[model samples]
Target: MTAGRVVLIRAVNVGGAKLPMARLREIAAELGAADVSTYIASGNLLCTPPDDPDAFDRALEQAISDEFGYFREVISRTPAELSQALTDYPFGEAPSGHIYFLTGEPSAEAASDFCSRDFGNGERLQVIGRDLHIDYPAGAGTTKITAAGIAKGLGVTGTGRNLRTTAKLIELAE
Candidate 1:
Protein backbone atom coordinates (compact mmCIF):
# COMPACT_ATOMS: atom_id res chain seq x y z
CA MET A 1 0.00 0.00 0.00
CA THR A 2 3.00 2.29 0.00
CA ALA A 3 3.30 5.07 -2.52
CA GLY A 4 6.69 6.16 -3.85
CA ARG A 5 9.98 4.44 -3.03
CA VAL A 6 11.80 2.72 -0.21
CA VAL A 7 13.51 4.59 2.64
CA LEU A 8 17.07 3.59 3.50
CA ILE A 9 18.08 4.42 7.09
CA ARG A 10 21.70 4.61 8.16
CA ALA A 11 23.61 3.87 11.40
CA VAL A 12 21.44 1.51 13.40
CA ASN A 13 24.20 -0.96 14.00
CA VAL A 14 26.70 1.20 15.84
CA GLY A 15 27.98 1.31 19.44
CA GLY A 16 26.90 -2.26 20.09
CA ALA A 17 23.31 -1.14 19.76
CA LYS A 18 21.43 -3.39 17.41
CA LEU A 19 18.06 -2.89 15.78
CA PRO A 20 16.76 -6.12 14.37
CA MET A 21 15.64 -6.02 10.73
CA ALA A 22 12.43 -7.74 11.74
CA ARG A 23 11.60 -4.92 14.14
CA LEU A 24 12.19 -2.45 11.35
CA ARG A 25 9.61 -4.22 9.25
CA GLU A 26 7.19 -4.20 12.15
CA ILE A 27 7.73 -0.47 12.64
CA ALA A 28 6.87 0.15 9.02
CA ALA A 29 3.84 -2.07 9.38
CA GLU A 30 2.73 -0.06 12.37
CA LEU A 31 2.78 2.97 10.16
CA GLY A 32 0.39 1.25 7.78
CA ALA A 33 3.09 -0.05 5.47
CA ALA A 34 3.52 -3.47 3.91
CA ASP A 35 5.96 -5.49 1.83
CA VAL A 36 8.67 -4.43 4.21
CA SER A 37 12.09 -5.87 3.71
CA THR A 38 15.52 -5.15 5.19
CA TYR A 39 18.99 -5.56 3.73
CA ILE A 40 21.93 -6.80 5.74
CA ALA A 41 22.37 -5.57 9.31
CA SER A 42 23.02 -1.89 8.64
CA GLY A 43 19.42 -0.78 8.91
CA ASN A 44 18.58 -0.65 5.22
CA LEU A 45 14.80 -0.96 4.80
CA LEU A 46 12.51 -1.32 1.81
CA CYS A 47 8.90 -0.85 2.71
CA THR A 48 5.51 -0.12 1.19
CA PRO A 49 3.78 2.62 3.13
CA PRO A 50 0.20 3.72 3.06
CA ASP A 51 0.54 7.27 4.41
CA ASP A 52 2.29 10.61 4.16
CA PRO A 53 6.06 10.20 3.89
CA ASP A 54 6.99 13.01 6.23
CA ALA A 55 4.57 11.77 8.80
CA PHE A 56 5.74 8.23 8.28
CA ASP A 57 9.35 9.27 8.76
CA ARG A 58 8.60 10.96 12.03
CA ALA A 59 6.46 8.10 13.19
CA LEU A 60 9.11 5.55 12.39
CA GLU A 61 11.77 7.55 14.19
CA GLN A 62 9.63 7.73 17.27
CA ALA A 63 8.67 4.11 17.08
CA ILE A 64 12.26 3.01 16.78
CA SER A 65 13.30 5.13 19.72
CA ASP A 66 10.47 3.92 21.85
CA GLU A 67 11.17 0.31 21.03
CA PHE A 68 14.91 0.58 21.53
CA GLY A 69 14.81 2.99 24.48
CA TYR A 70 17.29 5.24 22.65
CA PHE A 71 17.33 7.71 19.80
CA ARG A 72 18.98 7.36 16.39
CA GLU A 73 19.04 9.71 13.42
CA VAL A 74 17.39 8.23 10.33
CA ILE A 75 17.96 9.41 6.78
CA SER A 76 15.86 8.19 3.90
CA ARG A 77 17.29 7.34 0.47
CA THR A 78 15.43 6.10 -2.56
CA PRO A 79 16.57 3.28 -4.87
CA ALA A 80 17.60 5.72 -7.60
CA GLU A 81 19.43 7.83 -5.10
CA LEU A 82 21.41 4.82 -3.87
CA SER A 83 22.26 3.86 -7.47
CA GLN A 84 23.51 7.37 -8.19
CA ALA A 85 25.64 7.34 -5.06
CA LEU A 86 27.29 4.10 -6.15
CA THR A 87 27.93 5.59 -9.60
CA ASP A 88 29.54 8.66 -8.07
CA TYR A 89 32.55 6.65 -6.96
CA PRO A 90 35.11 7.38 -9.70
CA PHE A 91 38.31 6.05 -8.25
CA GLY A 92 40.82 3.77 -9.92
CA GLU A 93 41.82 2.12 -6.70
CA ALA A 94 41.05 -1.14 -4.98
CA PRO A 95 37.55 -1.35 -3.66
CA SER A 96 38.75 -2.41 -0.22
CA GLY A 97 40.77 0.78 0.23
CA HIS A 98 37.76 2.93 -0.51
CA ILE A 99 34.74 3.79 1.60
CA TYR A 100 31.62 5.83 1.05
CA PHE A 101 30.55 8.18 3.82
CA LEU A 102 26.83 8.50 3.57
CA THR A 103 25.85 12.05 4.52
CA GLY A 104 22.39 13.38 5.13
CA GLU A 105 23.25 16.51 3.18
CA PRO A 106 25.85 17.61 0.64
CA SER A 107 29.00 19.01 2.21
CA ALA A 108 31.19 19.83 -0.77
CA GLU A 109 32.88 22.88 0.82
CA ALA A 110 33.47 21.14 4.12
CA ALA A 111 34.61 17.99 2.33
CA SER A 112 37.29 19.99 0.52
CA ASP A 113 38.79 21.03 3.84
CA PHE A 114 38.42 17.44 5.07
CA CYS A 115 40.37 16.04 2.10
CA SER A 116 43.16 18.51 2.69
CA ARG A 117 43.63 17.94 6.40
CA ASP A 118 42.62 14.41 7.32
CA PHE A 119 43.63 12.68 4.11
CA GLY A 120 47.26 12.25 3.17
CA ASN A 121 48.76 12.69 -0.28
CA GLY A 122 47.23 10.74 -3.21
CA GLU A 123 44.07 10.17 -1.22
CA ARG A 124 41.29 11.66 -3.32
CA LEU A 125 37.80 12.56 -2.24
CA GLN A 126 34.75 14.00 -3.98
CA VAL A 127 31.54 15.41 -2.62
CA ILE A 128 29.34 14.56 -5.54
CA GLY A 129 25.70 15.38 -4.98
CA ARG A 130 24.85 14.12 -1.47
CA ASP A 131 27.50 11.41 -1.19
CA LEU A 132 31.20 11.68 -0.28
CA HIS A 133 33.50 9.15 -1.87
CA ILE A 134 36.87 8.76 -0.13
CA ASP A 135 39.59 6.69 -1.72
CA TYR A 136 42.58 5.70 0.40
CA PRO A 137 44.75 3.56 -1.81
CA ALA A 138 47.67 3.52 0.64
CA GLY A 139 45.57 1.76 3.24
CA ALA A 140 45.58 4.63 5.74
CA GLY A 141 49.39 4.60 5.68
CA THR A 142 50.83 7.74 7.25
CA THR A 143 47.25 8.96 7.38
CA LYS A 144 45.23 8.98 10.57
CA ILE A 145 41.96 9.48 8.77
CA THR A 146 39.24 7.64 10.62
CA ALA A 147 35.48 7.52 10.21
CA ALA A 148 35.11 9.98 13.09
CA GLY A 149 37.55 12.40 11.47
CA ILE A 150 35.69 12.43 8.18
CA ALA A 151 32.34 12.80 9.89
CA LYS A 152 33.61 15.70 11.98
CA GLY A 153 35.24 17.38 9.00
CA LEU A 154 32.10 17.12 6.93
CA GLY A 155 30.05 18.61 9.79
CA VAL A 156 27.80 15.56 9.73
CA THR A 157 27.61 12.17 11.40
CA GLY A 158 27.73 9.10 9.15
CA THR A 159 28.71 5.45 9.13
CA GLY A 160 31.59 4.65 6.77
CA ARG A 161 31.04 1.42 4.87
CA ASN A 162 33.47 -0.20 2.42
CA LEU A 163 32.91 -0.44 -1.32
CA ARG A 164 31.68 -4.01 -1.02
CA THR A 165 29.19 -3.07 1.63
CA THR A 166 28.10 -0.14 -0.49
CA ALA A 167 27.60 -2.40 -3.48
CA LYS A 168 25.59 -4.87 -1.42
CA LEU A 169 23.37 -2.08 -0.14
CA ILE A 170 22.87 -0.81 -3.66
CA GLU A 171 21.99 -4.29 -4.84
CA LEU A 172 19.47 -4.69 -2.04
CA ALA A 173 18.00 -1.29 -2.84
CA GLU A 174 17.58 -2.24 -6.44
Candidate 2:
Protein backbone atom coordinates (compact mmCIF):
# COMPACT_ATOMS: atom_id res chain seq x y z
CA MET A 1 0.00 0.00 0.00
CA THR A 2 1.14 3.56 -0.71
CA ALA A 3 1.84 5.92 2.16
CA GLY A 4 1.54 9.72 2.23
CA ARG A 5 4.58 11.90 2.82
CA VAL A 6 5.74 15.50 2.61
CA VAL A 7 9.03 16.16 0.90
CA LEU A 8 10.91 19.25 1.99
CA ILE A 9 13.51 20.55 -0.42
CA ARG A 10 16.19 22.84 0.93
CA ALA A 11 17.54 26.08 -0.57
CA VAL A 12 15.84 26.06 -3.91
CA ASN A 13 13.87 28.65 -5.93
CA VAL A 14 15.69 31.44 -4.08
CA GLY A 15 18.89 33.42 -4.62
CA GLY A 16 18.88 32.55 -8.34
CA ALA A 17 18.57 28.85 -7.57
CA LYS A 18 15.37 28.08 -9.41
CA LEU A 19 13.64 24.69 -9.37
CA PRO A 20 10.20 24.91 -10.86
CA MET A 21 7.42 23.26 -8.86
CA ALA A 22 5.96 21.67 -11.98
CA ARG A 23 9.28 20.11 -12.85
CA LEU A 24 9.61 18.86 -9.31
CA ARG A 25 6.22 17.19 -9.49
CA GLU A 26 7.17 15.65 -12.80
CA ILE A 27 10.33 14.26 -11.33
CA ALA A 28 8.44 12.70 -8.45
CA ALA A 29 5.97 11.16 -10.84
CA GLU A 30 8.80 9.83 -12.95
CA LEU A 31 10.18 8.17 -9.85
CA GLY A 32 6.83 6.38 -9.36
CA ALA A 33 5.49 8.76 -6.75
CA ALA A 34 1.73 8.70 -7.01
CA ASP A 35 -0.72 11.48 -6.20
CA VAL A 36 2.14 13.94 -6.57
CA SER A 37 1.31 17.50 -5.64
CA THR A 38 3.25 20.57 -4.56
CA TYR A 39 2.35 23.14 -1.93
CA ILE A 40 4.26 26.32 -2.78
CA ALA A 41 7.05 27.44 -5.04
CA SER A 42 9.54 26.44 -2.34
CA GLY A 43 9.62 22.72 -3.14
CA ASN A 44 7.17 21.20 -0.64
CA LEU A 45 5.74 18.04 -2.19
CA LEU A 46 2.97 15.74 -1.06
CA CYS A 47 3.15 12.34 -2.68
CA THR A 48 2.48 8.66 -2.17
CA PRO A 49 5.68 6.71 -1.86
CA PRO A 50 5.83 3.43 -3.78
CA ASP A 51 8.77 2.13 -1.75
CA ASP A 52 10.10 2.58 1.75
CA PRO A 53 10.05 6.22 2.84
CA ASP A 54 13.82 6.52 3.25
CA ALA A 55 14.52 4.91 -0.10
CA PHE A 56 12.08 7.22 -1.84
CA ASP A 57 13.79 10.20 -0.25
CA ARG A 58 17.21 9.18 -1.53
CA ALA A 59 15.89 8.46 -5.00
CA LEU A 60 14.05 11.75 -5.26
CA GLU A 61 17.09 13.69 -4.02
CA GLN A 62 19.31 11.94 -6.54
CA ALA A 63 16.87 12.51 -9.38
CA ILE A 64 16.59 16.22 -8.63
CA SER A 65 20.34 16.64 -8.52
CA ASP A 66 20.85 14.64 -11.68
CA GLU A 67 18.14 16.38 -13.68
CA PHE A 68 18.41 19.94 -12.32
CA GLY A 69 22.09 20.07 -11.46
CA TYR A 70 21.24 21.51 -8.06
CA PHE A 71 22.26 19.48 -5.05
CA ARG A 72 19.57 20.22 -2.47
CA GLU A 73 18.86 18.47 0.79
CA VAL A 74 15.58 16.55 0.59
CA ILE A 75 13.74 15.36 3.68
CA SER A 76 10.48 13.49 4.06
CA ARG A 77 7.97 13.10 6.88
CA THR A 78 4.88 10.97 7.28
CA PRO A 79 1.47 12.51 7.91
CA ALA A 80 1.58 11.28 11.50
CA GLU A 81 4.91 13.00 12.11
CA LEU A 82 3.53 16.30 10.84
CA SER A 83 0.51 16.00 13.11
CA GLN A 84 2.74 15.32 16.11
CA ALA A 85 4.92 18.30 15.22
CA LEU A 86 1.92 20.62 15.23
CA THR A 87 0.82 19.26 18.59
CA ASP A 88 4.33 19.78 19.95
CA TYR A 89 4.71 23.45 19.02
CA PRO A 90 6.40 25.07 22.03
CA PHE A 91 5.75 28.76 21.89
CA GLY A 92 3.08 31.37 22.45
CA GLU A 93 1.13 32.79 19.54
CA ALA A 94 3.52 34.32 17.02
CA PRO A 95 3.16 36.60 14.03
CA SER A 96 5.59 34.34 12.20
CA GLY A 97 7.41 31.08 12.85
CA HIS A 98 9.20 28.18 11.16
CA ILE A 99 9.83 24.49 11.78
CA TYR A 100 13.23 23.19 10.80
CA PHE A 101 13.74 19.46 10.32
CA LEU A 102 17.30 18.33 10.83
CA THR A 103 18.88 16.09 8.20
CA GLY A 104 20.85 14.14 10.78
CA GLU A 105 19.97 13.14 14.33
CA PRO A 106 21.59 15.28 16.99
CA SER A 107 22.71 14.00 20.36
CA ALA A 108 20.62 14.93 23.39
CA GLU A 109 23.46 17.09 24.71
CA ALA A 110 23.83 18.83 21.34
CA ALA A 111 20.11 19.50 21.14
CA SER A 112 20.07 20.88 24.70
CA ASP A 113 23.16 22.98 24.08
CA PHE A 114 21.64 24.46 20.94
CA CYS A 115 18.37 25.28 22.65
CA SER A 116 20.18 26.83 25.60
CA ARG A 117 22.04 29.32 23.44
CA ASP A 118 20.49 32.73 23.02
CA PHE A 119 19.37 33.49 19.46
CA GLY A 120 18.41 37.06 20.31
CA ASN A 121 16.19 39.22 18.13
CA GLY A 122 13.31 37.66 19.98
CA GLU A 123 13.62 34.18 18.54
CA ARG A 124 12.62 31.15 20.60
CA LEU A 125 13.73 27.56 19.88
CA GLN A 126 12.78 24.10 21.03
CA VAL A 127 14.11 20.77 19.84
CA ILE A 128 11.58 17.98 19.40
CA GLY A 129 13.04 14.86 17.89
CA ARG A 130 15.04 16.03 14.86
CA ASP A 131 12.67 18.93 14.44
CA LEU A 132 13.41 22.41 15.75
CA HIS A 133 10.47 24.71 16.29
CA ILE A 134 11.31 28.43 16.20
CA ASP A 135 9.18 31.47 16.61
CA TYR A 136 10.26 34.87 15.34
CA PRO A 137 7.82 37.60 16.26
CA ALA A 138 9.52 40.24 14.19
CA GLY A 139 10.14 38.07 11.12
CA ALA A 140 12.23 35.05 10.26
CA GLY A 141 14.10 36.86 7.47
CA THR A 142 15.81 39.17 9.94
CA THR A 143 16.45 36.58 12.62
CA LYS A 144 19.98 35.73 13.69
CA ILE A 145 18.98 32.08 13.95
CA THR A 146 19.01 30.81 10.43
CA ALA A 147 19.13 27.30 8.93
CA ALA A 148 22.90 27.46 8.72
CA GLY A 149 23.13 28.92 12.19
CA ILE A 150 21.00 26.12 13.61
CA ALA A 151 23.15 23.55 11.85
CA LYS A 152 26.30 25.05 13.26
CA GLY A 153 24.83 25.32 16.73
CA LEU A 154 23.37 21.81 16.82
CA GLY A 155 25.73 19.96 14.50
CA VAL A 156 22.95 18.94 12.14
CA THR A 157 21.87 20.32 8.78
CA GLY A 158 18.24 21.29 8.39
CA THR A 159 15.60 22.79 6.12
CA GLY A 160 12.86 25.09 7.37
CA ARG A 161 9.25 25.81 6.41
CA ASN A 162 7.04 28.60 7.63
CA LEU A 163 4.29 27.59 10.05
CA ARG A 164 1.58 28.19 7.48
CA THR A 165 3.32 26.19 4.80
CA THR A 166 4.01 23.39 7.22
CA ALA A 167 0.39 23.20 8.29
CA LYS A 168 -0.82 23.17 4.71
CA LEU A 169 1.62 20.41 3.88
CA ILE A 170 0.26 18.31 6.71
CA GLU A 171 -3.26 18.93 5.51
CA LEU A 172 -2.30 17.90 2.02
CA ALA A 173 -0.59 14.80 3.34
CA GLU A 174 -3.78 13.84 5.11
Candidate 3:
Protein backbone atom coordinates (compact mmCIF):
# COMPACT_ATOMS: atom_id res chain seq x y z
CA MET A 1 0.00 0.00 0.00
CA THR A 2 2.18 2.87 -1.20
CA ALA A 3 0.87 6.36 -0.67
CA GLY A 4 3.10 8.01 -3.31
CA ARG A 5 6.62 7.97 -4.57
CA VAL A 6 9.16 10.61 -5.57
CA VAL A 7 10.74 9.59 -8.84
CA LEU A 8 14.19 11.04 -9.49
CA ILE A 9 15.89 10.72 -12.82
CA ARG A 10 19.61 11.38 -12.84
CA ALA A 11 21.16 14.37 -14.61
CA VAL A 12 18.28 15.33 -16.80
CA ASN A 13 18.01 18.78 -18.44
CA VAL A 14 21.76 19.00 -18.11
CA GLY A 15 24.59 18.17 -20.46
CA GLY A 16 23.00 16.12 -23.26
CA ALA A 17 20.32 14.19 -21.38
CA LYS A 18 17.31 16.23 -22.34
CA LEU A 19 14.02 14.96 -20.87
CA PRO A 20 10.93 17.09 -21.26
CA MET A 21 8.97 17.25 -18.02
CA ALA A 22 5.68 17.21 -19.90
CA ARG A 23 6.69 14.08 -21.79
CA LEU A 24 7.85 12.52 -18.59
CA ARG A 25 4.52 13.17 -16.92
CA GLU A 26 2.70 11.89 -20.00
CA ILE A 27 4.73 8.68 -20.04
CA ALA A 28 4.10 8.13 -16.38
CA ALA A 29 0.38 8.55 -16.93
CA GLU A 30 0.55 6.14 -19.86
CA LEU A 31 2.09 3.62 -17.53
CA GLY A 32 -1.05 3.90 -15.39
CA ALA A 33 0.34 6.14 -12.74
CA ALA A 34 -2.11 8.30 -10.81
CA ASP A 35 -1.73 11.87 -9.63
CA VAL A 36 1.00 12.43 -12.16
CA SER A 37 2.95 15.63 -11.77
CA THR A 38 6.45 17.03 -12.01
CA TYR A 39 8.51 19.52 -10.10
CA ILE A 40 10.59 22.13 -11.89
CA ALA A 41 12.18 20.72 -15.06
CA SER A 42 14.90 18.50 -13.70
CA GLY A 43 13.03 15.22 -13.88
CA ASN A 44 11.50 15.16 -10.44
CA LEU A 45 8.32 13.15 -10.89
CA LEU A 46 5.66 12.53 -8.25
CA CYS A 47 3.04 9.86 -8.79
CA THR A 48 1.39 6.75 -7.46
CA PRO A 49 3.04 4.12 -9.65
CA PRO A 50 0.90 1.78 -11.68
CA ASP A 51 2.27 -1.45 -10.21
CA ASP A 52 5.08 -2.56 -7.93
CA PRO A 53 7.22 0.47 -7.26
CA ASP A 54 10.37 -1.33 -8.26
CA ALA A 55 8.83 -2.56 -11.50
CA PHE A 56 7.39 0.85 -12.16
CA ASP A 57 10.76 2.43 -11.71
CA ARG A 58 12.41 0.05 -14.14
CA ALA A 59 9.62 0.38 -16.67
CA LEU A 60 9.81 4.14 -16.51
CA GLU A 61 13.52 3.97 -16.98
CA GLN A 62 13.06 1.75 -19.99
CA ALA A 63 10.38 3.97 -21.42
CA ILE A 64 12.50 7.05 -21.11
CA SER A 65 15.45 5.28 -22.63
CA ASP A 66 13.39 4.01 -25.52
CA GLU A 67 11.99 7.44 -26.14
CA PHE A 68 14.98 9.65 -25.38
CA GLY A 69 17.88 7.40 -26.37
CA TYR A 70 19.59 7.76 -23.02
CA PHE A 71 19.40 5.29 -20.17
CA ARG A 72 19.38 7.18 -16.90
CA GLU A 73 18.70 5.41 -13.64
CA VAL A 74 15.35 6.13 -12.02
CA ILE A 75 15.29 6.18 -8.23
CA SER A 76 12.05 6.24 -6.26
CA ARG A 77 11.27 6.57 -2.58
CA THR A 78 8.10 6.89 -0.57
CA PRO A 79 7.21 10.10 1.24
CA ALA A 80 7.97 8.37 4.53
CA GLU A 81 11.36 7.30 3.26
CA LEU A 82 12.17 10.83 2.15
CA SER A 83 11.13 12.22 5.52
CA GLN A 84 13.23 9.66 7.35
CA ALA A 85 16.24 10.43 5.16
CA LEU A 86 15.78 14.09 6.00
CA THR A 87 15.71 13.24 9.72
CA ASP A 88 18.96 11.32 9.19
CA TYR A 89 20.72 14.17 7.34
CA PRO A 90 24.07 14.31 9.15
CA PHE A 91 25.39 17.73 8.12
CA GLY A 92 23.05 19.69 10.36
CA GLU A 93 21.43 22.75 8.69
CA ALA A 94 23.27 24.44 5.86
CA PRO A 95 22.38 26.91 3.14
CA SER A 96 23.55 24.71 0.23
CA GLY A 97 23.77 20.95 0.04
CA HIS A 98 22.41 17.91 -1.73
CA ILE A 99 21.16 14.43 -0.93
CA TYR A 100 22.31 11.98 -3.54
CA PHE A 101 19.85 9.10 -3.77
CA LEU A 102 22.03 6.10 -4.50
CA THR A 103 20.84 3.14 -6.50
CA GLY A 104 21.55 0.79 -3.60
CA GLU A 105 23.32 0.65 -0.27
CA PRO A 106 27.06 0.59 -0.67
CA SER A 107 29.09 -2.33 0.58
CA ALA A 108 30.70 -1.86 4.00
CA GLU A 109 34.19 -1.68 2.53
CA ALA A 110 33.20 0.77 -0.20
CA ALA A 111 31.46 3.02 2.28
CA SER A 112 34.40 2.90 4.65
CA ASP A 113 36.92 3.63 1.93
CA PHE A 114 34.86 6.48 0.57
CA CYS A 115 34.51 8.07 3.98
CA SER A 116 38.23 7.85 4.52
CA ARG A 117 38.97 10.26 1.67
CA ASP A 118 39.31 13.95 2.45
CA PHE A 119 36.86 15.74 0.19
CA GLY A 120 38.48 19.14 0.97
CA ASN A 121 37.52 22.04 3.19
CA GLY A 122 33.98 23.36 3.27
CA GLU A 123 32.94 20.09 1.70
CA ARG A 124 31.60 17.06 3.53
CA LEU A 125 29.72 13.88 2.70
CA GLN A 126 28.33 10.84 4.47
CA VAL A 127 26.73 7.66 3.25
CA ILE A 128 23.50 7.33 5.16
CA GLY A 129 21.67 4.25 4.03
CA ARG A 130 21.08 4.68 0.28
CA ASP A 131 21.20 8.46 0.56
CA LEU A 132 24.51 10.34 0.42
CA HIS A 133 24.26 13.58 2.32
CA ILE A 134 26.65 16.24 1.00
CA ASP A 135 27.34 19.73 2.31
CA TYR A 136 28.73 22.19 -0.21
CA PRO A 137 29.69 25.35 1.56
CA ALA A 138 31.32 26.74 -1.56
CA GLY A 139 28.11 26.07 -3.58
CA ALA A 140 26.60 23.12 -5.40
CA GLY A 141 27.52 24.23 -8.95
CA THR A 142 31.21 24.81 -8.29
CA THR A 143 31.82 22.12 -5.66
CA LYS A 144 34.52 19.55 -6.35
CA ILE A 145 32.25 16.81 -5.10
CA THR A 146 30.00 15.34 -7.76
CA ALA A 147 27.54 12.52 -8.29
CA ALA A 148 30.05 10.63 -10.44
CA GLY A 149 32.73 11.00 -7.78
CA ILE A 150 30.34 9.66 -5.17
CA ALA A 151 29.39 6.79 -7.43
CA LYS A 152 33.02 5.88 -7.95
CA GLY A 153 33.65 6.02 -4.25
CA LEU A 154 30.55 4.06 -3.24
CA GLY A 155 30.28 1.76 -6.28
CA VAL A 156 26.70 2.75 -6.91
CA THR A 157 25.07 5.29 -9.20
CA GLY A 158 22.80 8.09 -7.92
CA THR A 159 20.95 11.34 -8.62
CA GLY A 160 21.19 14.47 -6.51
CA ARG A 161 18.52 16.85 -5.26
CA ASN A 162 19.41 20.03 -3.42
CA LEU A 163 18.22 20.34 0.15
CA ARG A 164 15.45 22.70 -0.88
CA THR A 165 14.23 20.39 -3.62
CA THR A 166 14.45 17.44 -1.29
CA ALA A 167 12.32 19.20 1.28
CA LYS A 168 9.83 20.33 -1.34
CA LEU A 169 9.55 16.83 -2.73
CA ILE A 170 8.73 15.55 0.73
CA GLU A 171 6.20 18.30 1.21
CA LEU A 172 4.53 17.65 -2.13
CA ALA A 173 4.54 13.89 -1.63
CA GLU A 174 2.84 14.22 1.74
Ordered by lDDT, highest first, the candidates read: 3, 2, 1
Q: Residue-wise lDDT of candidate 1 within 49-144, one digit each (tens)?
A: 676665776688788888887766555566666667667777754554454445456466786777666344567777765576777666644556
Any idea what lDDT model 3 has? 0.88
**Clash totals in order:** 1, 0, 0
RMSD of 1: 3.5
What lDDT score is found at residue 90 in candidate 1? 76
- RMSD score of candidate 2 (Å): 1.8
Candidate ranking under TM-score, highest first, comes to 3, 2, 1
Q: Where does the lowest 10-residue lDDT sum fall in candidate 1?
A: 1-10
- Ten contiguous residues with the weakest lDDT in model 2: 86-95
lDDT of 2 by residue, 117-162 (tens): 8767777888989899888887887777767778788898879987
Candidate 2 — which residues are off by over 4 angstroms?
1-3
TM-score of each: 0.76, 0.93, 0.94
Off by over 4 Å in 1: 1-6, 51-54, 97-103, 120-123, 138-147
- In candidate 2, position 154 carries an lDDT of 86
Model 2 has a clash total of: 0
